[model samples]
Target: MIQIGIVGVGTVGASVARILEENQDIITARAGKEIRVRKGVVRNLSRARDVAIPLTDDVDEILDDPDIDIVVELMGGVEEPYHVVKKALEKGKAVVTANKALLAYHRYELQDVAGDLPFEFEASVAGGIPIIKALREGLSANHIESIKGIINGTANYILTKMMTEGVDFGPVLKEAQALGYAEADPTFDIGGFDAAHKLLILASIAYGIDAKPEDILIEGIEQVTQEDIAFAKEFGYTIKLLGIAKKVGEFVELRVHPALVPQREMIAKVDGVMNGISVIGDKVGETMYYGPGAGGDATASAVISDIIAIARGGKSSPMLGFKRPLESGLQLLERDAIVSRYYLRLVVEDKPGVLAKVSQVMGEQKISIETMLQRPGEGETATLLLSTHRCEERAMQQALHALFGLESVKERPVMFRIER
Candidate 1:
């Protein structure tokens, strides 16, 4: 029998406890043992829960217990859970976690601490999507080329509404919050931090590059506007917040931000609150994985999948899918060195010299405009929406800075990368 101890019996944790009992016979058959939830740790024990398992306010009741074989840490955050997971590993207990933030900061350290013991986090990246296993085992033979994903449901939901119904971001965001899709403070989701955490986890597994959230470039969709949507429609494009990881020569570029994806692409068609990931491998070409990114039952399904894998004696594989360095020659590319096509929006004074000045600044930075549109705005302001052919991140930054300093420019410009 495999005894389970779940910390933070919140929505996902309660679902984990319930699913274990509901699917016991089949789970036992697949796991080759009777799986049971012995106890769970919660902050408030007085609050009623649906699971029948014993609950406690103290964490040591489960962590210190001798019979608990698997420790499932669903508690959110970095430092507290890191200590909990570290201690759980120190006690020689196999652990499974859904905490992406904890892994984003301390994955390499925990990987070293775990050594050979079974430590699984299939639920960390995309909920109910078996992406971790696919990257670690299924495509282990192929050299990973790139990973482009829409991993956050709340942001995807907002973007989809913006694209389909032509509604602005504010109304859609409020609707999403009312529908229970977004939190009261939606910065973590809409600001791209949630997807950034998941992207870091995948980047570590695929490239073995150790990087924190702060180490990479992360931008939100807060700047997207109706003018930008009109430009996307004119150019056969759709705006979506994307988490991108690409292998460029010896460097890996990791970034998360709103992007203008071609409307004909499969990823662009993935609308609503659905999550989709497109992974390109040198040997196998491109593959897509799509599903609900987060929900109590969906997330619990992934947590339980890890538990089953551990129960079946599947512990020999390395936690990050590599024994040593993934590729010693490959390193993390600097944020300023990234190269891609871009879409730029500038609200400026409606004057003839403004376009000439903007073009001159871009040319000075070695940026060439491919498409352009000018729409009259309120008063003397006009919206200039332009798409650049291709340019380095440094050059784009320099051009934006120069444009910002110009007297003709009214507001700070908005830009989104054009994913080709």
Candidate 2:
């Protein structure tokens, strides 16, 4: 029998215990042995929980227990979970975690500490999608070219509502919160930090690049407006917040932001709370993985899969699925040097020379406009919605700065990348 100790017996933890108990016979047959949840650790022991396992307020009760063979750390945070997982590894316990933030910051260090120990984190990236296993093992034969994904369900939900119903950001966000899809603060999910953490995890497996959330460009869907949605519809495009990672020569580009994806693309069809990842490999071309990104049951399904792998004697070769750097001399591309097509929305005074002035500023920065649209705004203001040909981010940003100085320009221009 494999004895398991789960820390943070909250939503996912409770689901893990329930699944183990309810599906004991099948789980035992698949794992080749019976897996049991011996105990659970929680911050408040007084709160009633659904699971029948022994619950304790102290973490050491599970961490220090001799009979426990595996430690499941579902607790959410950076420092505390890191220390706990490190101690679990030091104690020679196999660890499975769903903590993406912890991995984003200390994955390399944990890989060092968990040498040869069966440490698994399939639940960290995209809930039950199993993209981790695909990148680390299934697609190991090919060179990973790029990964584009809609990994965060909260942002996807809001964007889908905005596009379908033509509602604004504020009302949709409130509805998402009321539906339990978003938190009260919502910054972590809506601000793209949640997807950024997941991207860092995937980047490590595919490229062996050790980068934190701060190292990449992360922009949320909060800036997406109804006007942007209308423009997307008009141009046969759909707006989605995308986490993108691509290998460009010797450098890898990682970014998370709202994108104007062509409507015909498969990824653009992934709407509502569903998560989808499109991985392009040099040998296999492109493959898509789709599923529910998060929930108690969905995430628990991933956590339990890791347990089954460990049960089948899957040794921990390397946490990031590499013994050494997969691709050396490949540095992370600087954000300012990124090149992509862009969509810009600006409010300008309703005058003939406004468009000319805007075009001149873009021309000075070496940016050429691709498509343009003008709409009547409140009073003497007019909205100028335009898409630009591919250009360097630095040049486009400079042009935007120059446009701000123009007297005809009104508010700061909203921008989204156009993905072909």
lDDT of 1 by residue, 258-348 (tens): 9999999999988888999999999999999999999999999999999999999876489998988854567889999999999999999
Q: Residue 203 deviation, candidate 1, in Å? A: 0.6
- Compared with the true structure, all predictions reach lDDT values of 0.93, 0.94
Worst 10 residues of 2 by lDDT: 321-330
Prediction 2 TM-score vs. true: 0.99
RMSD of each: 0.9, 0.8
Q: Candidate 2, residue 378: CA error in Å?
A: 0.4
Runs with alpha carbons beyond 4 Å of true place in candidate 2: none
Tell how far residue 207 is off in model 2, in angstroms: 0.5
After superposition, candidate 1 runs with Cα above 4 Å error: none
Our tally of clashes for model 1 stands at 0
